[model samples]
Target: MSISPGPSNLYILARTMSDGHRSGVAAAGGMAIGSLIYVLLTALGLAAIFRYSPTAYTVLKLCGAAYLIFLGIQTIRASGAGNTSKPKVRIMGMSKVFKQSIVVELTNPKTALFFLAFLPQFVDPQLGQVALQLVILGLLYAILAFSSDLLVVLLSHNLGKWLSSHPLFIRWQDRVAGAILIGLGSYIAWQEFIQK
Candidate 1:
């Protein structure tokens, strides 16, 4: 479930494809690094804070939604002025992508909650150091997630290349991506506020 092509992952892949395979790979790397941090934080008991504090979770969720909105607005603005033949002049660097992805992952409280609820079922207290065991499992999960996301990046990059050839698609690609982000952000807000 963790490795699934969620909204944030798809957004990162699409954004990175603007810069080619290298960017896609970097985006995947960033995502993996972010997930790794979440896993470690969950192992270290950050999940407890999320679980117990609804307000904290809500705050994080809103921050994530806001960030998505920001990204969406940026994409929409770029689409109007973007060129299809070459990479966008505003193409993000690996470090910027890394930082953005990490923040996005961190603000997603559900990832931490998922880790909290899921990783412990396999634990055996008899083996000793529970924290160590959790850490190992979390690292293993991170590896699996990275493997899956890398595959996604490769596929998305190819698809992006195909899309780039079509003049209409090239013109609309960023706009579509931006709209998706905005919709996802709205969905998150609805899930957090209306559903509850």
Candidate 2:
């Protein structure tokens, strides 16, 4: 969770928007939806494919890293060109934000792997339906993550407001997000390539 950029980037996106609360909620919702997909897939044993096929896992990691780098470049390019109105009109609408958040979450292959590895530890096949147990645990995690991310969103939004007076700060928000994303992507890619 700490290694992933989804929450931090979500905070950054929320900070730049006029309706921080709404954007934050939308982003959280999107992330939950994306995670739901992964959880479901993991419950269905799809993630076993990754565990059995090291090549597939590596390919997914590479793809995820590439996607992150792409997003970082896009954020950097859009930084200074975003909305200029009071409170800032938001670079994108709630729907777009929702979609972006989903994409960000979905592209991180590690999330699926995480759900696969983490949920089963809590499940007792003899106690009940394993699939149902996995889903329940996954939902609980999504809710908890969303709650934590909401706090981050609120805090970042308030900080954005405090920094809004300075155009430089406003302009740098996306740049900072972009840089972090790029760094994360590069690191992930490096780990995949170098650790083996």
Candidate 3:
């Protein structure tokens, strides 16, 4: 699951391609922190609030979708204003990217649900201190996930560096990234709407 193709991974890829390795790593760090926050919440039984409340989950999912769409539109508009003589790369600050990544990860109900379900299967009542076990498991998961995301950042950065040389790619890079984000957001919203 750590290496799966999901919103987090796609976002990392897009950011690395558009910005650079620093931004991508910042995103990965933020996502790891976000996952760790979820781990803590799960350990404390706070994550169960989502399981018991469909309204909260739906609201978060929709908000996440809306945020992604908003970012995508902003990206596209930024691309539109780019000059051919100078590529419009690295428009966002690394700190902003980090914060946005955390928001995106937290808004993902699936991550919350995944931890709520996946962590307990490894937990043993006989081991004592169930919460500690959950935290350990969650930490390990976060580490693995961060490692995977880091690899993605490195590879995508390399690819982006190569593609950045071309005039056409530089011209359309933001559009492509924006489209990917919009598509992911739309897919998530459509899935949630249809499920309802």
Candidate 4:
């Protein structure tokens, strides 16, 4: 279901509209919807794909590994080339949001468990359309998460510009974002293996 823009979304939407910050907002938006899809799938009982198969998580891990490692590689590469004036934005009406959201949601096994463990606290089966309710809650969390991240993005976007142009802070933002993404990818990969 498509969410309507309301007062709740104003904070995130406003932050996203800022220069350089839109990419993160766009990314967070995509990631948010992706996670919601997974939770929705789980709520609908399609989590069976993970349940019945041992190799499922393996492939899932690899896909996640590939995605994160790809991001890491891109970040490192971009850092080497110096900064670009324009922020990156992928143009997809739905797929961008869907795919990125899923990637963010599946950032780690812990995130999955987080959804499983925490969602139930708010989801009462007695509620009509529990799945829909979960979707709403998921969207709410997305709004909050994106709001925070976008604030960071707004700050960092300028920071990236200033640092890269200066001798002292040269390429610091790239290194930081790249290293963090690489670390997160490695962490997720480790979780996939150890949890097995």
TM-score of each: 0.89, 0.84, 0.94, 0.64
Candidate 1: stretches off by over 4 Å = 82-90
Candidate 2 RMSD to the real structure: 3.0
Number of the predicted model whose lDDT against the real structure is largest: 3
Off by over 4 Å in 2: 1-19, 81-89
Candidate 2 pairs with clashing backbones = none
> In candidate 4, what are the lDDT values of residues 1-196, reduced to their tens digit?
1233311122223223322455556655665565666677667754556657757757766666666666655656656544345443322334443365456456444445445556657878887887788777776765665566555556656655565456434434455555666666676677677977
For model 4, give the 10-residue run with minimal summed lDDT. 6-15
Quote the lDDT for 79 in model 3: 81
How would you encode candidate 2's per-residue C-alpha lDDT over 35-146 as one tens digit per residue? 8887888789876887788888788778778877877787677675655464554556789877877776776755756786666788998987888988888888888777
Q: How many pairs of residues collide in model 3?
A: 0
lDDT scores in order: 0.74, 0.70, 0.86, 0.54
Better of 1 and 2 by TM-score: 1
Best by TM-score: 3
* Superposition TM-score, candidate 4 onto the true structure: 0.64
